[model samples]
Target: MLSIIVALLVNLLIETSVSFSVVVPGDPVVAHVGSTVILPCWINPPENAEALEIRWYRKEFSNTFLHYKPGKVPDMPVEPYRNRTSLTPRSDQSGGLKDGDVSLRLEKLRVQDEGSFRCYVSGESSYDSEEVDLKVTALGSTPVLFLKFLDDGRVNISCKSSGWHPKPSVTWMSDERRVLHPGGVFYSREAHEMFSVHSWTAVSRSDAQLVSCSLSLKTGELKDGRMDIQGIVSSDSSGPWKALFFTLFIFALLGFGLVGFFLYKCRPGKKPDKEIVGDVNIEEPRKHAVEITVDREHLHPDLMVTKNCKIMRDGPGYDHTGEGFPYELCAFGAQRFTSGRHYWEVKLTQENTPPKNYWLIGVVKHGNFTVRDRSALTPSSGYWFLCSDGPNGFHTNTDPPVKLSLTPRPERLGVLLDYEEGQLSFYNIKESKHLLTISTRFSGTVVPLFNPGAGDQSPLIILDCTKPVKSAEESSQPLLSNNSSNA
Candidate 1:
């Protein structure tokens, strides 16, 4: 019993010899406007030292600081940090007595709390050595995507935030419950003391409606703006629709003016309006009419595609591909394009038979993304067709072959290719949308691309591609007609 008592006393003495350490205040940082914040901190030594008192401190001047004493408050501290501090002891977290987790916890944080902090501790030994420092910052106000008005009845929107230590990203969402990806504007400028971003996209297209702009940051998610307008507007209609559209147009234009003033006067850095990042140059015209040939191969009705340039699936939530092949990245190509006044066109086809499942087009951008339409071409007898329009201009797509009346290649004029069972498509110098399943009798998407009409923009890259196999021959026999069926 005597020996055991001696052993216990020695152990307690050794433990009491370790120095106290800090748990919070390591570096300066930022917190979103309304985030439940934690101030990380820990002290040194080992296990026995866990019971040490934890305190939080803030240095006012070089030598003066405001600190909190553990268990109970110390006599009286400086006026600045009197009632604004707290200490949380975490024995399980402290690196044993060798280290301590005497961190600070601050509630209902305010903007002024952005600065340097200290994790102080009190223990048995000499009340001793400490841990490290921490920095706190005032994050910017929640940035709200503002849907304001524009002149001429079009809609204009912008995103704004303030007080953020590091810049945040802003995105726009429409009533379609889709994200409007921003493509051109990735650069940002400093506003007052925080970061600010203003992107302009003229909303003028079919089936347009309500939208929301979302702001995200390292701090957290903060949505703060609302759509300020009379009502909804559809891009597919005219007239009375014109009234609401025009109203949004005028308001959006006005919003544009306000954003311009703020961008010019408040924003620190600026770039030329026309210097778009994805801008590629193309001016060469195709001299020899290129040919697309296909050969019937596999006996499966699935999609497969082959192209010259590598593809990039930029929009969020999309992964490249699978099985025998993977996507490779490369530079972009230029294809000729004539703005259809306001949108672009694409021809869609279904090689086998149209499935009950549906697909939509996602326009990739950095901040806001735009989805053209859910049903590009509806299933007709064996195909589907559509004419799509948006702020990006106009575009046409393939439809299930219509019954007489009248239905040309793509409403406009382009190359149309398909098979008897399914697989429909129309591609020009500028773009291509080959989404379909080839009849098992012909399972391969091998379209030998030919440079047509004008311009070199006929990029080697083909987008939204399904699994396609490469082919290089123009077969005429019905049994041998690969149909190149995969669009």
Candidate 2:
């Protein structure tokens, strides 16, 4: 007749210094009120089950209390366990039925325990072993934090305490040990492998000369760590402010002198101080063409038509293109030529028809002309363009050098000979603006004319073309296109 037993589920074991084992009945059991408890138990093979005997006991006056055999413990109380103890088997859970887990349990444990208890589960002629110990915790106190600075201007605050089942955490107070508004504080734990309690703090100096570090720990214990930290309190070095001050002082003196001079000259009572106008600040040297000797008596008819004479077929040297229209000025005649002033006439026509295209000339940067868009003019200091003669002058004709001319007249345009800038432009003298500029070569060889008829077609013509340079002011503007060289 198999019986079933059931009782406390908490297991207790016999404790050795390093390990504990489940108590088998009949063994002396020792227990500490606040220490852990373990129940010794193990599994028995089905064939080994019947012979087992399990018992529960206590050492009040030193003796066994109850005996467990199969489904029931015998009818004896053994005194100390008269009502305080009971041992029963679980049919549903015999000792180690699954894998030799003969687990047992205990209740209302007290200290002063110092012996082995047992659950004797004997197999049909043998038994196996399993056990556990019961331990109680009495953590009784909280941890605290302390603050201090090291000798080398470092912080040496520490946190510590005892009376904890596991250590407790201690964090530094902000206001000298009390909580304060925005005091940056740090934390660390108690120095224990149990990971119980901890404490921490941040140490900083009173001024910019101070260095700070944060202590982190679980036990809030003390240990040496790198003093190096993240927050920077101050800098140790100074800069060159003194040098800069001296330099600026000298500059102020010079500026003061100038201001004083101005105030004295233009005082309210002084009728706006005045001085004779100085020479004009011209970009180029003034000296206009002093004197000019015409190579031919009769100029190119084309030069006469629009009065764009005062020119020569430039370049046969450093002139590269052998092309540019090198206009020479009749410093005196330029002003009157456009207004239709009369001039003495000499004659010398080209020995042969001076070709269809030749240079026509006009003043560029002076007289009636000026470099309106600096981008269109080179900054060669002495550089200038020939103003335009009328278009009909040299662009087209039966005899270009003769059909249209550059001598005298009003509009702007003339045979494009060559130039330094990439493209050459023709201007309308009468209209006072650029007519158009031509690109790409019209013909290979350009001819010259000593004197050609005037008043037929274009005026100022470019002989060789080169890229135009942008003046400082023009360079600041946005570019139009990659190919565009001038405004």
Quick one: how many clashes does candidate 2 have? 143
| Candidate 2 C-alpha error for residue 62, in Å | 6.8
TM-score of each: 0.33, 0.22
> lDDT tens string, model 1, 95-139?
533344445556555544566665555655555323343333445
Residues 362-455, model 2: lDDT tens digits: 2222221211222223211112233222343443111101132333332223222233322333333323323333332221212222222232
TM-score between candidate 2 and the true structure = 0.22
The per-residue C-alpha lDDT of model 2 at residue 224 equals 23
